[model samples]
Target: MTQNLYIPASTGGTLMSNMPLITSIEELTAEVITDLLQAAGSLTESQHVTAVEPVSFGDQSGLLSYLYRVGLTYSDGAQGPATVVVKLPTDDPNQRGISDALGFYNRECTYYNVVAPTAPFKTATIFGQAQATDSTDFIIVMEDLGHMERIDQVIGATLPEIETVLKALAKLHAVYWGHQDLENLSSTFLPMDNPIYHAALPGIFGAGWASLKVNAPDLLDPEIIEFGDNYSTHLPQMLAALNTPTTLLHGDYRADNLLLDEEGNLAVIDFQITSMGNCAFDIAYFLSSSVTSETRAAHADQLLHLYHDTLTAEGVNYSFEDLEAGFRVALAFCLIYGVASFAGWDSFGERQQELMRSMASRTIYSILETNALDSLNAN
Candidate 1:
């Protein structure tokens, strides 16, 4: 069962204010672990953590956050997992600013606190959570799901894996298709039509293109570069077209964020960009970013239909034609991600650079193959 004890520094008053905004692994001491667990009702007065060993995900972690595998020893041999995953804000000021501006930290914390328990798909269990008053800083002590097999995005995913993930994604869309919870938390899970996106994405995209010109010039040819230059001008229409048929979106649904087991169970993580949008956008983002061009060319039609079939089987009214059309527009917009990859060029190493290259190449290929921008104009 997932714990519901979320004490934000803004609202938890005296007690939570006392809970340190842990910005580093060194601050995640044995005493701090006891407080977090106790606050979440996972520990008692007599039961406390006596020692902690934290191993950081120095390079494998996301740009917006730092991750650690914290091994724990409890007093009197009280029961608990040998280790748990601790997520904290990134030390990079620029990255932290980006996270705050985009509301990434607050969104993920809120997703676990409010939405995860009833969510249809699998995700890490939140043992404890604390957000700063400004929502810029937060800590998530969650289940250590590192044992699950993670797919490599640079190598890309197989047809079977994509099929399984899409089917599960369809179910997630079906369950939250027009749920009131979406409306109740509209501010936290911004609808695609939100003006804030219009305000922020253009500048970020422009910066990304500039960064790429300097760092990864070979990645973008003139034609693709021309399309990127005109992306912001077309943003409003694309976003307007994507706003309908709203459902819960796992905004960054890709290979790296997924964990699969032998039984074929799929667990999704990284809800930083979680929002409300057309379900097809999630499908587009997943396929364009995670699968190779060959896989998409051979199986795109079948895989898309599989998602449509799965969604309709759950009684959704979306048409296959509409899904196809929305997919094209979504694919065009996925360039934002590929382009954004360059914005953090200094932060990424050779492996991450390879992954970004794969993503950018596949995204550009799919866009041209489908004439995604023309589809967007038609929309």
Candidate 2:
């Protein structure tokens, strides 16, 4: 008997039906493609896939998954999508082990299967999603956003673009603000203190710091490193702060994960790190990692206030003062990525290296500006 995938149908969209777990792009036969399209309600019974061509997509830096752009043709002499994106697990044993241990693959599969349908902001529409019971094998067939322009994290976003991101985030936070339903999804969406996260934290932070110290020494301030070393001791307080009126978070909400159309409408991708957390973590992560120090300095406060006003307009009772405090605390949390990315710098190209460097620098700056360490150290 086939095991039932736990996708909730209440959110109202096409749900994956009878899709098989695909471990690699090589497994995608024409029959499989047709089945996927049919399952997503994209094709009628008369329609069938005639041909498929898979090509590598973007940077091959994703540690846990391989990405492909698949071109297709229909059997009826009809042109189908010029291309769709497919995400599959990486073959590398070490990376795969890390991903499995940390539950990254399962989290993303659950997001596409359930959470994305309920999100207020636009995200890639899933044509197919499946994962193994062990979470070692997974695949996601999604709408191709290749034609859209992606914001470059190294170059940074303009003021208007940042405002757009903040508005989108506000909508997402408002919709799920203080919703008790999040607790019901705990198995799929882990909290910050999940044992998997705890198991992986030391290695991730240690490797990231070692990399930053060796590859990009300038970005690592002595005080920042010191703060990161002691961060674990403050976990209890940090967790308490994060649990204050929880909301859904797009954990890695950076410029690189967002796509924009000509009209500047945004669509997000990469839900591998999606979780339940304070909305401030997303806000702080975006500003610190996606924007340059100068841009953040000039507009961070105004943009933060924009998020507050937007949430207020949506009937959320959160105050600007509380939001500001959360934002400050969340900056320290952003250091996790700053350190980890620097550790894995060689996996990225020169452009990504520069982006990671900027991210680390700005993250440290934000932490200091808000006296984030002091707040964490306080009773």
Candidate 3:
């Protein structure tokens, strides 16, 4: 049986209406707009949103959510915002099935409503967030950070950018490092020790691997394929080894999910996969998947040291050797996502395909360089 989790939007002192959830952009009616504005604190009792002009938003290819941007005008002839991005779950049955199965939507909603207030790192400000009982019907209305310059994952990050990301991530990890109360949090934040994840990940990896082999054969080496094939079984022990002194992980921490303001401060989005895990998981995932192979080869050591130094400065007590070993394991663990992303190659255009290929190349290279497969199997 699947459990349902629901999180109501932040009402910010206003009474919430019993409006039907907005599941798609087409359903963004005037009443829905008013409800959202009130919940987001953008409208007071004296002010009301009279109209909305829907604007263009994301690439429309998000597997989990559909994004929309809309400008709102108030009754008092004032504009609420130039635009705000509205995120609603993808209506596709297959995609919704995966999200529900993994508790992705519930986790994200929890992040905004429960976690963001105290999180150390910068994330998109949530004006409102809500989910249906089943977690399938959900929406997040947030400040549009689209104006900030975004790094191209295919082009990869520069040395400065890599340093910035590592430092930011270190701060986030340190905040919850070995917090005694973490286990009492929602099951949505559970580490891989949870049986639900142990049961689900293997099948997901196998399906993804099968698709990659069929769709992008040239990218897979036999060693990498075999590593992926056997990974699901080995995952339990490997995750157990890596799970100690756990912290919050920004599960999809990558260039594509990050944006930089004019002063170059980094802000992150997409907490759908946020979980409790070794900090090295995010570190390895970012370094292996978001940067070019050459960039990582050149700066991997320095980057790891930077992350370690930051962690130490924040009063965490892990040694460099510990970090290095966890990093290697994490690099191998990342192959699961690297292969899984290719399952949607047919939906990708030339540039998207190029990005996935580059990520794969970098991930495979890191796995081989660190002898990640051998390490996992040996453990």
Candidate 4:
């Protein structure tokens, strides 16, 4: 956990008014990696460590710890690159945060194959132990696609490119269709499964909202706060309605986690929250999160038609009208989550916190104040 007892916003001074400690972003700490490999039973004294660091990606990835890939030379000179991205849980008590985050790493390695050449998604491999004795437990060693950029950056992705990504989701969901009996079956990706919806509600509903209504009244209204409270109350029923014939959901199925190969093929990554839920969950995820709100709002119906068209092309026999109905039902769920994303991640600051608290208010308000639920009710 950040040692700092963070105020809702910066108090205009050092994060810690008194206490101070050092933080590093150098190559993987040899000691940390050594402890990791030792715990995994893969460490030999012969293996030498090179580097470790918390890296920054794009403009939005501010809080991530990206241990940059390295060269691993075995005793006999057999060598490979260390490409594991270990996302550890912070003891941060906000929500059962890192607790839920661990699921993503588990799903990625235990369920989703990182190296399988079967799909067009940016695949990643899992390592032995998720983390050391610390709260951080999920670790991933992946086939580094560092050479490629995310599809979002590669504008004008040909029909083939988009087709590849959408088809990959189809192929995955098809394989895992209705897999509830298995011991390691996937769980619902986001929705109320998120820590905020689960554990952070007290904080959000209590201090967070109370603070907002008093200090930042312009950011939210009474109805918004009510929506947040009601959403939590409605979570179980909402999730029950969402768990139709399940498909593998790439929890965060946005371009951010997708790496586009040299040939512009899509490879999905960041499966920490992979779950079994409505196939519409994945569709809602892709369209709602991947496309900008403006573009998606303008093209919502068009895109809904396209998803059914894409699914049909892949040999799945579902009618557009019906599928769109399912998707629309899921849209209220998506819109709630989507609006909340305005709080965004990638950095730790007052602005981010305010954005999150405000957006949560907006999410609450919008869900309650308008006829937004009409989409879910239309059919």
Candidate 5:
């Protein structure tokens, strides 16, 4: 579809113009990029600042962003493009979870030594520090993974591709488990009594599953409330079960968050939700989140083996026992996460709401109808 270019004459020289929030691409300059970098704390008081033009991509913030790609030709003539993402601010005032989540992203980089795309920021030019703008506005300068494919595109791939992601998921889970104190990992993971878990809401962790059952009764069985309560009831056991060998699990390891660079190696984005929970939560969430039921059913055994075999290969000492257990416990993880996020899509601009919710509604319907919880439990 051709973007409708706004012409001043078309509106008969109105006093106001409905230009895109960010300025036109041709107007990007070194001064603009320098200002954005400084906003994110990338430049010092003395350093020369210059920004090339910016190109933007799909981002969640309502603010339009321009990716300013520039070359810093230094005094010694060494030059390279400094890729910066410029976002002025978002319009969402009541939004929550920006700080701790960005902290988690930075905190994960501290342990995992991996670059995080979703929450990239810098306190200094050389080191990474998660910083937020005071007025719910900011820009982020990040590493550009040149020509890498997004995980979203590869998700519908053949068996081997799925295996690659599963193995990586297991490895991530195993490597970062128990590296930090639970309080530091996620207050949400600790019981509500834990004061650090203070501001956290138990809403999404399990309640939304019950609410969805209440809201969508025609499509889902009311018995889902039983499953939801079972999850809440077994919270202590679930916490105890977290004692199983842990690693840094990518909380949202869906295809959309994984990037394939020019070399086709996987680079992950979105560190905002990184947590110290059981590895299976991420594995099961990633495996189940985006696909259709027919696809999931057809590929079930093959993909399970991919996850297990990857764990086994990495010497995680996983078995069918571990996989099934993870699979079962992770079911609630998947269902509830879906329910918690449903409203976001429902209100996205009409087309966005349509596409995102259509897929999501199908996912929810399929999950309930397929008895993902029951099947995982049965296994």
Candidate 6:
């Protein structure tokens, strides 16, 4: 059954956006959408939304959110976006619990609302967004960049693609490197050393480790298991190390979340885990998890130098050696994501499972090749 809500846009602003607040997809009626778009000044008074067709994406799309690509129709010959993407909180209780605890919903909504506009790199254009103070309820409607090329994280990204993302990252980090407004931003974008994360992530990682032992035992050998068991004990010290040289980190930077258009414009998505940390965390995670081990091994030095040089050119004075050290620390920290993926192993489809396997293997390989574990204990 289709809903035909006809409320005026003037009645909808509730601190998040002037868009109609919709907690569920069923509430996204044409009349409601028309009103919101009108309030946003995206549509003319004579134009209105006529129809909508929403298609749900799978877990491979994103584990933390319920994603949909909504096709739209306009009243007559009115011109507007042909489609838009909608993000809602995940229905899975386990994932939802983690998101709620970590403030993922608010972080993403805040990113789209504040950071995305002035970010050094391209991000999806926001059409409307609404997030509840309760943290469990939120919705974001944005431009659909599905037509852009996305590198397959399962197959791994090529050197050119990796370089492209790294360059963009350097620009982003440089802009925010020791910026004055960092303290103000902390209210919405939690610092890497936030107490809430330190309290919650250990248990989350441990849950993932326990789950992996049952479902994907082969991925973790005795050595890795030993490391996993001790991860919580070392987490505080590790996060302390990651807290310096603070800048905005995309937090979940990787191939799956990056898209490129024909004109070579790159757009990054999925800011759910955005945080304030040493930019190396983003660089290390991308190199370790998104690119193949073989590719990383062959070009690791050159790529690291590339990022450092780019940052240097932008007038940041960090040394290559210190950046390398930070990179290693971040690589050791990267295991949490791979280990955590298995917490909901049963729910992931084969594609997501394959991507996780690729990420785990690559991350471990990077850790070993760089002796990242040694950095954790470095004085």
- All candidates' lDDT scores? 0.83, 0.77, 0.77, 0.47, 0.47, 0.82
lDDT tens readout by residue for model 4, 91-184: 3343234345444433444444322333334465433323322323434443457777765521223344445666677666554454433223
Q: In model 1, which regions exceed 4 Å deviation?
A: 1-20, 38-45, 60-62
TM-scores for candidates 1 onward, in order: 0.92, 0.90, 0.90, 0.63, 0.64, 0.93
Error of 6 at 311 (Å): 0.8
Residue by residue across 1-379, what tens digits does model 5's lDDT show? 1112111212222112122223244544555544444454555444545436444464453211223343443223323335543323233321234333334323332322232211222111222122232222223344555456665422344455566667667665544434444444443233213333222334444444544455455545555556556655554444455435555455666666666556546666554455565676676676566555566667777777777776677556667877666665665546545555433433345543333443345445545644656643553
* Residue lDDT tens for model 1, 119-216: 77789987777777745778888888888999888889988899999999998888888876577777878898899999988988887778877877
Q: Model 4, 143: alpha-carbon shift in Å?
A: 3.0
After superposition on all C-alphas, the RMSD of every candidate to the true structure, in Å, is 3.2, 4.5, 4.6, 10.8, 12.2, 6.1
True lDDT of residue 119, candidate 6: 81
- TM-score of candidate 1 relative to the true fold: 0.92
Q: Please list the residue runs of candidate 2 whose C-alpha ends up more than 4 Å from where it truly belongs after superposition.
A: 1-17, 92-95
Candidate 5 residues lying further than 4 Å off, grouped into runs, are 1-49, 52-78, 86-94, 97-140, 153-158, 177-201, 205-219, 225-243, 350-379
3 against 6, candidate with superior TM-score: 6
Please report the TM-score between candidate 4 and the true structure: 0.63
Error of 2 at 48 (Å): 2.4
Judged by whole-model lDDT over C-alpha atoms, candidate 4 comes out at: 0.47
What does the lDDT read for residue 24 in candidate 3? Answer: 67
